[model samples]
Target: MQQAGIPTGSTRPFGYKDDKRTLEPAEAAALRKTVERILTGASPRAIAADCNKQGLTTTRGNGWSKETVKQVLRNPRICGYRSRKVREFNPETGTESVRVEPVLDDDGEPVKGQWSSIISVTDWEAVTEIIGRNPEPGDAYNARKYLGSGILRCDKNGCGSHLRAQKAPASRKKPEGFFYYTCPDKRSGYGCGGVRISGPETDEALKMLVISKHEEEAEDRQATGVPEEWEGENELARIREDIDDWTERREQRLVSKERFFAFLAKSEATERRLVNERNEWRRPVLRAKGEPIDLRGEWGDLDFVEKRAYVEKTLLTVLVASAIRLGGPVRDRLTPIYRGED
Candidate 1:
């Protein structure tokens, strides 16, 4: 039924009415707006909050959540497509798990559903790619309120753990806001537990460093020339999809080894080159309209998600040390390494 374009399920999707196939005007509109906002750099948490405020609920009549928003956007059904479960057995566990993948026809084309799409295929892919990668945004608790929460690392005696935002009382060095990017101690069952830096100060320092690096990259691009928009995103998606399909076919014994290996050698080489190209064109900060902006001034306006995404892109890691070990000044206590740097 789904392959023939008829939407089917135990319960109608969030944007559909009781009939299951027809779109509910209000719900569909909200879904569309949410997709647009996410593509424009709005975090899932922000969108989920907006939905809950507007009295929107999931198909199960529960409040909106960041994970729910991501799941809905990643679903191809919103783009008028059908998906099926690919069950694979785990050898070690002696159990099977399943993955929901797009339903493909015999000709290797996606099965188009009969229901109308809430968003275009292009927009849908972009949404999925964004929500799916760059550290794969976790649940609400992991939504990230601090800029350096996950990006900053503890460099205490090789006890490397991602620093988290912790509350602290006012101190002489950190006089305001009363927060620190403190490393979890043995009580947390991990980490050196000794690294604690002023939260507000660390955030400000990292922001400026990222902005400076971004500025330098932009200046370098001026001579070499850069594209107006990031290209090959859709192409990369297609390549990945093709690779998955090829592997699935082999696992299912639908294709012989000779055919699979022939495709793999060529596909893997192409995927590698595209990945390198993407890394080269990486922009650490992008707010809206995909244009250059004044990072120093506009940095405060961006939400936590955007700031973290930008920082993670530009720097592989920010290895932070305690005041005693990292002497000199606040800036000297940390080392920022650019992504792709050795």
Candidate 2:
């Protein structure tokens, strides 16, 4: 079974039939449409919602999700490559671990699968490049309880460390306990010297701040109006030119391999940054046209992960000042730095 290029599982890829030898026409078509939509600037979240509306399900018969759609887009199997998960057992510990490894042909390239390709290699690569530019979501394994753990930054002088949420020490006044966001450096005795802020108060402050910003943006759109077009082409073109120049230099042996790779990394980072900035420009236009979300009403109902995603999308950094006095005044200490504005 290991010698064969088949996945050692019952589940087949979404665009393929259970037999794994035939293409499911409808699923294949859906995959193609998904890639096309992504290239045309539709987000994974939008695509997933559309899939659900159309009664589409994953290969495992589950509802479509952003992560699911992203996985499908990133899978090399769509290009006819064979992917397999190999499980190895350790004799000493009697433990097993599984790792995904691509099967290779005689020439050491990825093995072509028995099934027909749903998407061409070029199109698959293009889709991957576009998706790679988007910011990835935080890990869901250890989902945060407080919304501000990673997004909030300690604003103590000479120490701008990320704030972490931890359960506040139990006291006679409130034995049930509470959470607080404190500088990890201070907690670890690294000497950040930052003050801890009440988690519930910070959350409320952030919600209000987000709502206020949203309202302000709405008014601004009504007055000045959203931009008619994205002006990011020039910057993106410059970055691509730099990438090509670096590639040519590497090919011509003008730059060492290490330097070439470093230049490529920097260029790619800049490209992703510029692409995100371009997306931010489009978001306002979408909001004006009533296509994007307005989180005011649904804010309280969201879970920690959902709230974190919203905060990350809207704000770049939340600065936490020293909480000199607790309770209502703590809300005034928080300063939200919105994206594109900073």
Candidate 3:
């Protein structure tokens, strides 16, 4: 008897035929397009919505969902690797653990299948990294309810604590409680000087900053004649070419092994950085198509979660400065670090 190679299952992955031995041209194209969109900063939710709007269905013939889109993007099978489920019994715990292990070739690398690959290994890895950077939805208490709750850095010159939301006690002047973003140093008694800022006031100031910076970016784009529909596809292509060139150089013995590895690491790092920047660059275009940038007219209409996502996607960091006067208001400095701008 001979050992089985690829599984002869009735069902196949989305980008392959039912026999799993050939590429379904349309499906493969769709998968590649999705990867390109993701590299340009399309969120899973946005991609899912677009798929459904276009009447695209999953491998199982169901409408696409965010989780479904994410699972498809994360699937190694799309890269032409074969995987199998292994079950292990745990006698001590009276349980079994199941895991998917990729089949390896003689070279100890993941075995390539007969089917075509829809995405390159590098692009797949970049998509995975981008997905990992996004925050997951939370439950009741853990949900983001205030802007800058998880984003604001400590005001102390050298302290690195993140500010957390604290509810002020009810009083005669204000029966309802108010929220303040206080430094974790004070909350945890770490001995770093404390800083607190009014949540509403800080939120409003941040909104203004977002609006002003967005306008500036728009003007810059107009002056530079950058296309509104431009994505980072060209830049990604250049980075991929550089990576291939370095690999060829190392293979041809034109560079020392140590130097080759160092340069390869730097090239990969630059690729990741470029992917992030491309995503940021596409964000404004996506927002303009989907949601209105009503920072002034409809600012209060957005919920806490939406507002937090907006801020996190737009700004890299918000550094709060402690009040100069003992009883003065705390000040914050914004860094419009999105779109690879310093």
Q: Estimate each model's TM-score.
A: 0.54, 0.47, 0.52
Locate the minimum summed-lDDT window of 10 residues in model 1: 283-292
Reference-based lDDT, residue 47, model 1: 75
| lDDT accuracy of residue 309 in candidate 2 | 66
Worst 10 residues of 2 by lDDT: 133-142
Q: What is the C-alpha lDDT of each candidate?
A: 0.74, 0.72, 0.66
**Model 2 agreement with the true structure over 146-165: per-residue lDDT tens digits:** 77767788888888788888
TM-score of 2: 0.47
* Position 191, candidate 3: lDDT: 28
Runs in model 3 deviating more than 4 A are: 1-7, 53-55, 86-101, 132-145, 153-164, 167-201, 204-342
Clashing pairs in 2: none
Q: Which window of ten consecutive residues has the lowest lDDT sum in model 3?
A: 133-142
Instruction: Give the per-residue lDDT of model 3 (tens digit) for 1-342.
Output: 002236456678898888886889999999988877666445566677778879999888899876677767776667766666567776997877554445776534576666677888656666766665222332214367777766777757668577778787565254355677777754467526567777767777777776666566545544554355446678778877987887788879998999988987887888778777765655445344433333444345445554566677677777776666664644433333453556
> Which sections of candidate 1 miss by over 4 Å?
87-98, 133-200, 204-310, 314-342
